[model samples]
Target: MVKLFNEPIILKCDHCGKDLFADSQMSIIVFVEDRKNKVIKDVYVCCKLECDRNLQEIKVKEGLIDGWKDLSDLTNPILFLNQIMATFNRMKNGWIFEPNAFEKLKEIYLACAQYVMREPTESEIKRASDILGLPF
Candidate 1:
């Protein structure tokens, strides 16, 4: 049994929803690697061992990831949102951040704060409510 150094949380199987343990015997380590053989992120994971084929072939559909997704398929809005979050975290953590990036994010935050501080006109409030998917 390989050292499952990471704590395992029992997950419900997607197919049958059976509570499966995340152990070396019952699970495989999912790893992600870059083109240079460096791991970036390990995404999808299933809590079922593949070696028990001969014991009892539980038709555990090959839902095993062992791979990654194409990031290029994401939309610009989603990318922008992710960038905003990452930038925010970087600044909060006090990392060596770019001055220009900090200024831009500060501007965005200031503009938003200013907008929220001022009392909006009825029409503006209505537009805001509609934009927030609220019933107003």
Candidate 2:
């Protein structure tokens, strides 16, 4: 007998509206469960921390807390910036299956900006641009 996978026909990123390929390394899957209703809602997003953050925000707006890690832990600006660059470099070097490093970088950059309460400095932008070889 043969078995079949139950992949959804149309799985788009809950945060960025990007198409999510089944079982792809570039995809992040979140299963939110409601114990009272005994239902699980599957959330699919691209492999970016910003996407996860956005999903948590949306859930908070809806009064559902799934006990995700606190975003406040990323408050250290220098460390946060390092993480962004590392993730970007990995994606660019084909460590991750995603071809679009810009999307991932943009998401992380926006999150960093929000935390810092200011737009990215010219130097920061230039650094990222130099690494990715794309005009930021």
Highest-lDDT candidate = 2
Candidate 2 local lDDT, 21-85, one digit each (tens): 43234555443434344333332344347777777666544533343212333335775576567
lDDT, each prediction: 0.36, 0.47
State TM-scores per candidate: 0.23, 0.31
lDDT of candidate 1 over 23-58, digit per residue (tens): 323432222323233322222223444332321233
Q: What is the lDDT of residue 135 in candidate 2?
A: 69
Per-model root-mean-square deviation over C-alphas: 17.7, 16.3
* TM accuracy, model 1: 0.23
Q: CA lDDT of 119 in candidate 1?
A: 49
Residue pairs with backbone overlap in model 2: none
The total number of steric clashes, by the backbone 3 Å criterion, in model 1 comes to 0
Worst 10 residues of 1 by lDDT: 67-76
How displaced is residue 25 in candidate 1, in Å? 46
